[model samples]
Target: MVLMLGFVTIVAAALAAGYLLGRLRPWRRAGDWAADQVRFTGAWVRGGVVRQAVVVLVHVVTAPRTSWRIMRTPAADTTAPVPVRDPDWVAHRTRADKGGTP
Candidate 1:
């Protein structure tokens, strides 16, 4: 039980230290570089097949709805016209409030 507790403590301390170090700018940049390198290596290994598959998958998921919206004509408007105040109403109010002629 004591040995297990010690091991857990050591792991917790290591994780905390790693988290702190990862928050530093240099460490963060290094991590990003490593991640990019890994991604590049993965893409190189998979060749064009994975890239084409990803494109096809994205198109299959998104193209139908977007293409339909773009190609389809809009429905005709049938709603009643919205009521709006006359443009001269504000000018009349301002003149009346300033003691000018109605």
Candidate 2:
């Protein structure tokens, strides 16, 4: 148990020393470099997450049922109105059909 404790203490000291050395390193000294790295890394991850959400949203808008036709691309039909299902009526009809009535 004493040997294990000594080993743990040595490892912790080494890690702390290494961390201090990295902080004092010449390349890590520039405030702008650190700021730029932080900004760039943060922007990369943030943009990735936002980009994913945009892709999903765009896909949802472009889905067949949504009929949210794209203005970026050519329209599928110039005159056909987009479908907007009435949920209450649809549910009522579904119940009637299930009871063997149209």
- Candidate 1 stretches with Cα past 4 Å from truth are 28-102
Q: Candidate 2 on 1-102: residue-level lDDT in tens?
A: 999999999999999999988888754344334334333545434667775454445444435333244325574566668998877875557656678665
C-alpha lDDT of all candidate models, in order:
0.60, 0.57
Cα lDDT of candidate 2 equals 0.57
Write down the TM-score for model 2: 0.26
What's the TM-score of each model vs. the native? 0.26, 0.26
Per-residue lDDT value at 73 in model 1? 59
